[model samples]
Target: MTFTAAALIAASIAPSISNAAVKSEGMKVSMQLAPTADARQQVLTQSAVQFSKEMRRLWIEHILWTGSYIVSAISGLEDQQQVLSRLLRNQQDIGNLFKPYYGDAVGNQLTTLLQQHIMLAGKVVDAAKAGNTADLNKYNAEWHKNADDIARFLAAANPSWGFKWLQDMLYTHLKLITDQVVARLKKDWEGDIHAIDQNEAHMLQFADVLSDGIVKQFPKQFQQ
Candidate 1:
């Protein structure tokens, strides 16, 4: 069984939302997109697939949140950094797990984003260790800018997956960075907050779940 792209995207972009929760929706759609399997096997098999150009695109989409995470940390508006740290670490771990799936082009992009994130994170950690507010702010600003560019590039290069997926998932994350997150950040900057948060995180989880579903259904296609 295989899912349609629209159903899969809906499931992936807004699982928490009503459209996604329909038992016959995403899972039904899953049959059309992939095969229906238990969640445990789904996780195990998808984990086995090597990263590919498609996966790399997905990775970049995930990493785009690095900006929001950094800003959240810098402003001390949220206490999710520890969770975010785990997420980042998991992404790094997954990158290694996925290295075998990517071609040279995809691998290079993955490597580039990973390096930038590491360097940026390191600087932030170092600033915190040294208690340098100025440095932290500087790096946080850079993180925001870099994240914006990365997100834009991702959308431009792969609009189908990037913006389409993002817009669909937007509903999940919009609640987190609502007036509160924006107001706080807005005080400092005279522009958009790019306030992606818990909802966005939830959407990413859906994407991961769907990707895993695809891999489980078509191991050979993904395994390389």
Candidate 2:
């Protein structure tokens, strides 16, 4: 699932609108231009695989990295600013993927909501670090609510997102995220490792579902 610059740049392989010269902007997108339909399919498959792989790497690694900082909470543990930067970068990557299909406004809005998701997860980690069960419950609920917002937002945008499935998938993402944080707090290395594996694997499925939905929803974008 390795994605080269060419693979990504060219992976917006969807047919152009009226054969217009293709281009992209931040969080905006279009489809790939392949030699043939089969080539296009291969490109899309690679795109989905790469999308999932990068997503899992970025997000799961984010949890592990940030969780380390939270658990330690010692001076000079790690650069907090750098952590935030990485989070933003990961999200921006996602927004860029969506931009072509959703356009700039929608893409930016999606990124904003997703940013809220990241902030909420940070809050959960903060609550866990404080050992405040009440706060943890509160923030956890908020985090879940954010997931619902994400679900509704996406489902409203594209029926292919499937409200129930997307909601469940998002919740699973949150739950596994919690698993990692809680395990870190409790020093449960086995549980943490297990959650990491689960989170990465499940997220790939989500990626596939998302890619499938996009392909189905906008057939012209992917099909000639």
lDDT at 24 for candidate 1? Answer: 29
Q: Whose lDDT is greatest here?
A: 2
* TM-score between model 2 and native: 0.69
- Over 59-122, each residue of candidate 1 has an lDDT whose tens digit, in order, gives 4455455545545554554655664665466455544444444445554564466556545654
Per-candidate clashes, comma-separated: 12, 12
* Candidate 2 Cα misplacement greater than 4 A, ranges: 1-76
True-structure RMSD, every candidate: 13.6, 15.1
* lDDT accuracy of residue 176 in candidate 2: 60
Give the Cα lDDT of each candidate: 0.42, 0.58
- Per-residue lDDT tens digits of candidate 2, residues 1-224? 12221122121211112132123222111223211123124445454555545555655554555455444442234676576667766666676677777799888888888888887777666655655556666766677778789889888887656566667667656656665665565556787677777666666556655665665565566543
The weakest ten consecutive residues by lDDT in model 1 span 26-35
